[model samples]
Target chain A: MISFQKFRIYINKCFIALICLFSFVVLLPFLMLIARLVKSGLKYICLDFFTQTSPSPVDAMLANLAGEAIPGGILNGICGSLYMLTIALVLTVPLGILTGIYLYENRGKKFANLIQYLNAVCYGMPSIIIGIVVYVSVVKSFHSYSVLAGGIALSISMLPKIIRTTRETLKLLPAYLKESGLALGGSYTGVILKIIMPAAKGGLLTGILISVSRALGETVPLIVTALGCSMINWNINAPASSMTLLIWDFFNTPNMVSMVWATSAFLFSIIICLNLIAKRIGRQWKFILYHE
Target chain B: MNKNHILELKSVSISYSPGSYALKNISVSIKPNAITSIIGASGSGKSALLRSINRMHELYPNIRMQGEILLGGKNIMEMNPVEVRRRIGLVFQQPNPFPTMNIYQNVLSGYKLNKIYLSKSEKDRIVEECLRNVSLWDEVKNGLNKNPLSLTVGQQQRLCIARTLALQPEFLLMDEPTSTVDMFCTNRIEELIYRLKNNHTILIVTHNLAQASRISDYALYLEKGELIEYDKSNIIFVAPNDKRTEKYITEQVE
Candidate 1:
């Protein structure tokens, strides 16, 4: 008969080896995608890529038929994305943080419980469904696909993320911190704003950054609301373009493959830079608050 | 109610839920300008009794308190809890100086929380006076702007004391303030308590019977949820009173 202990040890080793092999298999395609994008994307990047507006797809098609080069840049998309993302962030951050604070302070209350359940349901809702909802509510009401509608849609998608993260972070704080504040004669609002909020600053900022990043790359909501413009537009009531929209639209065209790759690279860099800045700020705040 | 008593608890009973009591019908009067220590085993309601003085127990949604707690002849139950807490400061068991605040800010936190603005010079004077009262001035004088976490556990506890004192409260409630520190810090804190009794009415809850005898002017012994005995500290420590008190004291020593 086989020894039971020996069989158990062999099974554990086999499981470990299998996990390692699967992890490497998962990592290989991701590394290749990044490498391919960087190699092709580097050559198309130029100062003009960030300085001029994108040409219309019809204009590019006609130029291709006439044996002429398609001429334009992604500046309109970059500008539009930044403007819409800023509006969405402003709309969502304050409301989301306030909701999170209420949930934490009035924990186990009926209204707070209802809100928590609703937030969880909203977080799990698909981005496309949210886009369609915003289309009917804001886009149809305004009688135009506009930047404002797009921003509102993005805000809805990001709100649940910010609220959940803020609540979870605040919940991790020790109970004694609040008690200490009360013992110092602080009112409830005073303790929350001065002590608890400041203590959770790094986590709150991280949540905001994560929400911004997610909103920046979102495509489906902007498609249904903003409807993609080729010209640089400053009016919030007018249709606008974004990097993700540019990539989605241009990739399907026969001659605009290079444009799509370049926009992808630009989008990748923005996300990387944003995350790096967030991590650095978190480290600095932690060092100042705790290590010193 | 005697005018000499700064705090009086009359038939006070606390329960977290129906049909159960954490502190049952406890009554005691604390004299002004004296240190009173409440000594009991764990789960004997020492901390609960102390929290009732500053209305800290009301923070919980399920807690129920009956009867009256009078502060200087005024019923604390009828008073605003924020105002009552301002007049009666508390120090917790663990050293919890606001981790985000510097020493100066931590000391001035009471003023800031109450929205009581002060001139820069006034703030400076208050910080110095409060820190000195806890005997932490010389050690932390050079690093006044440093984070409170940079200090040792002992110093952090002292800083918390200074933070409480900055409110200029009439009574100071300390719940096992030295239980988490070293013996040397314990001795120093005990000495500070002794000195502070000259100006402020102090109520402390401690599990250490020896500590109660060492620093308190009066001693209260609690068993389960009942007040078994209370008298002058020297008499309670030296003379025999209740059999439970004697047994507990001897058991601690042995």
Candidate 2:
């Protein structure tokens, strides 16, 4: 019996080691990607990279001949990205949260179940397809690529994710908490705003942050809708450029290929920061409720 | 409608689905400023009856409630649900303090929910009085800003009671309030419930027969969703009119 126990322990140790090895293997690619991006991208990420517009192909080739770094930065891309993101977030946040609340409240109903099914389909739908749909609907209708079209497409892509998170977070809370609020003689709106919303804020914040990062990383839809502007464009009706668009532009142009790495690295850093903040908030809020 | 009784249920029947009934024609009159314990085995619909009083039955899907529940002569079935709920408070089996709220906020949650603006002094007075009424003021006086979740289960339960009591409703409905607390906390809560009867009419659903007999002025014994006996606690415990009540009491005593 003692010998059998010893054998079992040995097997358990081996299993744990194998599991750890596999988990590390899963994380290895992410680490390598970051390492490569940092190595190739660091040189061009100077003050000019952030403050100046993208260098023209001729200008970049001239700089290359002189063994100089690219003269212009991705300041246009940064502004355009921020502008479209602001529009997308403003459109998506309230709409997503409200839809999520509706789905949660009416769960098990046929209409809610159907909407949930549609939302899941939308969530898994290819971004390229969404890009095409927005292109035809918004860009084609207006006869011009516009920041508004890009914002609308990003909001569409973000809606399903935000709805799912809001619903799931609300579902995780005990039913009695809402009931307790209602029992206090508060209206449904009052209970939801004061009791349910406050309790779910942390989870909601994490979800919204994740969605924001996901939206920021979006490329295909913005490609079809925004169409990538060369100069800084303030007019909503004019074509705008984002970080992903800049990366795409550089990747296509031979002389500007090196700028792609720097732009990708910048985008990656912002997403990492968002994810870290989400993780911190998620950890803090996870312990506050449902302890019982 | 009895003029003496503060709340009356006339043939109140609650069904979760189309055909089946969770509570069958439960008609009971409750006196003001008294502790009435609804005692029954599991699945006896004690909770359903308690919830129906405050329109909480409407929370469930396909839940149908028949018959009139009269609160102070006004038919609650016809009254606005928010108004009915405000006039009567319901505590659940588990302590459910608003997780994001501090002790002081939890106490004042009812008022906040109702949008009744209270000045700083008024807010302070209400929170202190409610917490003290539940005998939790001394234990948590210094930590009013601390999360209510940080408190022990018993303390959290009291905080929940204080939250409900902030509205100063005429009626309090508690479903297994002490079921999750320790014996010491249970004793404290029982004493508090007994004292609360001086100001508010209280209806409590409990599985503990001993608790029912000890704290209640009037006891209601239910079996299979039917009221088997309803009388003064002494008479019901010592000499129940129904054979089922006696059998249940003897079995529990064993």
Question: For candidate 2, lDDT tens digit of each residue in B95-141?
Answer: 98988888998999899899999999999999999999999999999
TM-score of chain A of each: 0.89, 0.95
lDDT of all predictions: 0.89, 0.91
Proportion of native contacts present in model 1: 0.88
Q: How do the residues A1-292 of candidate 1 rate in per-residue lDDT, one tens digit apiece?
A: 3699899999999999999999999999988878888998867788878898987778778877887656688988998898898889999999999999999988899999999999999998899999999999999999999999989989999999999988987886767889999988899999999999998898789778877888889999899999898888889999999989989889877778778888898888788888887788777666755564
Best DockQ among the predictions, by candidate number: 2
User: Which CAPRI category fits model 2?
Assistant: medium
- Superposed model 2: Cα runs more than 4 Å off: A1-21, B1-5
Clashing residue pairs, candidate 1?
Answer: none
**CAPRI verdict (incorrect, acceptable, medium, high) for model 1:** medium
Cα distance off (Å), candidate 2, residue A242:
0.3
TM-score of 1: 0.94
Error of 2 at B98 (Å): 0.3
